[model samples]
Target chain A: MGFDGDDTLWHNESIFSMTQERFRTILGGIDAAEVDRRLLEAERRNLGLFGYGIKGFVLSMIETAIEVTGGEVDARDIQTLIDCGKSMLAHPVELLDGVAETVEYLANSHRLVLITKGDLFDQESKIARSGLADLFDRIEIVSEKDPETYRRVLARHDIEPERFLMVGNSVRSDILPVLEIGGQAVHVPYHITWAHEHVEPPAEGYRRIEGMAELTGVIAAL
Target chain B: MGFDGDDTLWHNESIFSMTQERFRTILGGIDAAEVDRRLLEAERRNLGLFGYGIKGFVLSMIETAIEVTGGEVDARDIQTLIDCGKSMLAHPVELLDGVAETVEYLANSHRLVLITKGDLFDQESKIARSGLADLFDRIEIVSEKDPETYRRVLARHDIEPERFLMVGNSVRSDILPVLEIGGQAVHVPYHITWAHEHVEPPAEGYRRIEGMAELTGVIAAL
Candidate 1:
């Protein structure tokens, strides 16, 4: 079994938040909430325009700032946007529930791998900070995650897709790729899922669990 | 420019947080620091597998939990994961530094919009929670973000891409798409950025800033 990280096993992304009060204060007489709504729209627009990458998101914010300020924008506002963008690269990796336990339980019977992606250095640094290494039999990081990646991984391990069980929260990265390659996969929903990975009406041969805690049973069923 | 609401603007995400102190407790006998190191590696691997969405993040936690506990996992652990996951999803929206002040200041001249991608109900609720809805001249939500989407939006607004600016913390969503269309864009660094949006070689015509407060200068420079 393999697991995905970031928002899953850890509480990450604490840095990206914006206070509603701050947004309200900026828009002045305008409703702060309305500002949030507009910002959300802008993000959707940017995401549609760019896909799931970091650079475009930062630009969207700069664009939002200019638009919100009605083009009377000044250095102070730009600086605010700039500073946020610089460090936006770091994610505070906090752990999730049953993440430790479930992995351990599964480790008893399965060969586990930790697969993730990022700047490489950042990811490695986070793992070093996490204090829970040495559990997986293997760990791999790759730029692209899809059926091809899953197939290659399985082939490398000499493990049949049916003999391999993939557990994750996203249909995009975990379930879909693994399933696409004829591997069994399980899904555990996390909080605040991104829109892209959302599977409408679910997919075939896919199972859902509320969280990591339910993994043992799911694994048993598998 | 657009912004990423959940983590970029404010403090969000708490899925992996629950296990920190607990991990310290359980693995006290081991090199806690070392354990964290290995765990962090596993986490990086997980992110690549899961991407930026919430579901895979949660799964990473469970996998981490299982790895750390050495098969001593239990119900309390699982409960913790789910509870934390829900918290991450339902947690209050927070804003980054100077965002409120900057937004208000920018509102004096610019046309601001919120662009985000997420679940409909969740995104709408967050907009309400963020309290910045009225700050924007418009709000748009879409299922995808790509270069084509950016082109269409600019075309619909009858705004020349060169004259238009996209500001955001995400290189993938905000900066690149606008730049791809020959639009001007700015990069504002947020403290903590989501992993899925990471990009490289920043797009052309990208101007960088430290925070939204810098917008005043940036707008003037333009």
Candidate 2:
């Protein structure tokens, strides 16, 4: 069994949403919605260069601040942006409801692996803080969660793709990729998502549960 | 035998140095030397939050720009910073002199694994571009090159630490960690060094060679 770390297990995009809202207040002249759009644009542009993580997000925010402010952005506002990133890094990992119970239920009988993507330090820090580190048989912190990455992880552990199952919130990162590679997947939607992670609904042959609490039921059904 | 990817096998920190010079040019009115100092300081401060890689460096540059400019930084200067990151990412991977020949020579007789640390996407991309992928039995892209990380890799391969040999540029990252774990190491110094990677010279019991061309001789001596 494989689990996606960010939104699937805990609160992630909510932090980004909250930071973005704060950004609107710091750069007062711009329309709040416009600032959001521009920030997203900058993030998309930076994905290839910066990859993904809070650091990249912070850089995009700074870039957008400069563009939206027309080079007149306040130094304190820049400081505020830096602080936003710092606080997010310092933020405690808040597990989604029922995650612990579900994981505990399954780990008792099955091998559980935490496969996550993003900054390595941040992910490791969160894992350590979550106090659930002992639950996993192995922990894979990858650069991106894709079909190839899933295949590689499965192969590394000598587990056939048919026997592997992935559970996560993002269809793009978690479900579709695993499904494409001949693995079973369960999607448990989170309330908030980054635009980058939003994708078309999963195709047939995959399960979608309302929340982590429903995860054990799906696993039993499988 | 294990290889280090960034500076030891390919040009990495030189790109950082060149980018820093450009940053100095863009953020004029501050001492160029002072710009370098502040950039390094920002990078150290952000390492825990951002991790290592070009993305974090770019973020630190932006932060330093704001501080040094006293909130008056030009919008174009911000674009220039973004461009620096993009160009570095777009830059081709240049293998260090004699790396290909030496690796090919050693791989015929010994197991070679590429152990590198940084953003997963960036490291994987460089490995693909280096065209030396077929030479390694395994590739481990990790968060940090610590003693624990070395132990894990060695154990994963079923190779004892006493039989493992690590070769890289940084004394901080490559030599000491592997040495602490009872592995032999060869330090092939790169022309440029990042402050974060510098440490007290290898204490003792480590081989220091001038270039990759001298690597095989050290291996034979070991």
Best by DockQ: 2
Measured against the true structure, the TM-scores of the candidates, in listed sequence, are: 0.44, 0.95
lDDT of 1 by residue, A120-209 (tens): 334555665666557777766544468887887777667788888877767788887787777887777776565445675355687788
Runs in model 1 with CA error above 4 Å?
Answer: A13-56, A68-70, A85-91, A201-204, B1-222
Number of backbone collisions per candidate: 200, 0
Candidate 2 residue lDDT tens string, B110-219: 99999998877788889999999999999988878899989989998999999999999999889999989999889999988887788888568998999999988878
Write candidate 1's Cα lDDT for B1-222 as tens digits.
445454445555332344444554544565777666655665577553333443334444445555566534443443354344445556767777777777677777887766654433345556767777777655544334578867766665566777777767777887787778887777876654444457784545678988877877988887
For all predictions in the order shown, the interface RMSD in Å is 20.6, 2.1
Q: Which ten residues in a row have the lowest lDDT in candidate 2 chain A?
A: A70-79
